[model samples]
Target: MRIIKKLGNAFEFFKGTIAINLAVSILPLLFGGLLLFNYSVVSFGFAISLAVKEINSKKEYLFYFNNGLSKGALWFYSWCFNFILLISGIFIFNLINRLF
Candidate 1:
């Protein structure tokens, strides 16, 4: 239950982040669904997009800062989320291709 709630909170924090979602989804498709080799682009895109979004909204930056999450941590999470998802998705895709 606690884990679910924490995930929900994280999702909410990244609500307006569309670029990351688009990059992760489209780039993999464009690259033959094999994006592990280019996961850095996805991660960097997420970090930059999130930083731009937060910078544009001072209230958001302050909110997170006041709530104990620094900007660095937010960016780290953004990058990690996209990078890990890209790696996992590509790995699974390759595995399925090999098995089937």
Candidate 2:
């Protein structure tokens, strides 16, 4: 339950940049990049989201800090969650593609 709450907080922090991050993740695929490259781009997208949030939202960080989540923990959970989602989505898409 504690871990889930922390992940929720991390996701809240990540939500602001989801649009841009998702665009970055998808662009390489649209350009026909390899699967490895797409995965790397997803990670890169998350990194950019973190960097942007760090620069733009100091007070928001304090809110999470008050809730007992460190910057490092927030970043780790956010990246892990989003990366897993991306990988799962890719796998499902590939399966569908192979079938059709």
Candidate 3:
């Protein structure tokens, strides 16, 4: 019975951790995406800064921080992907213009 209780507690902890991580990852991306779409660098910086502050302030909040970080990273990567696409398009446009 004691072992079963311990297992249950451990499982609960694991579940909570997963939930926190997921939440942290999502929140940043949502805000970041909105800011990106609007080309609001100030808002993006503010949002990410707040997230970093929150992550650093509370050790117990580490799970949430990690989740947020994951989301932020995803947002950053997506932005990078878009930037690369734009550059490629510009290069192709220039090449075509020069050729014609």
TM-score of each: 0.59, 0.79, 0.33
lDDT of the candidates, in the order given = 0.61, 0.75, 0.44
Count of clashing pairs, candidate 1? 0
Query: What does the lDDT come to for candidate 2?
Result: 0.75
Who is ahead in lDDT, 1 or 3? 1
Model 3 clash count equals 4
Best by lDDT: 2
Best by TM-score: 2
Candidate numbers, best TM-score first, in rank order: 2, 1, 3
Candidate 2, 20-86: lDDT as tens digits: 6776667666676758455754677777777777788878878999888998887777777777777
Q: Candidate 1's residue-wise lDDT over 1-100, tens digit each?
A: 7546544445556655645556544655576544443653565456556766867776876776665666676566656665666677678988999999
The better-scoring model by TM-score among 1 and 3 is 1
Give stretches of model 1 more than 4 Å off: 1-21, 24-40
- How many pairs collide in each candidate, listed in order? 0, 0, 4
lDDT of 3 by residue, 7-92 (tens): 44433333333333334445554766533433432244334444554465455345533444344443344344434543665588
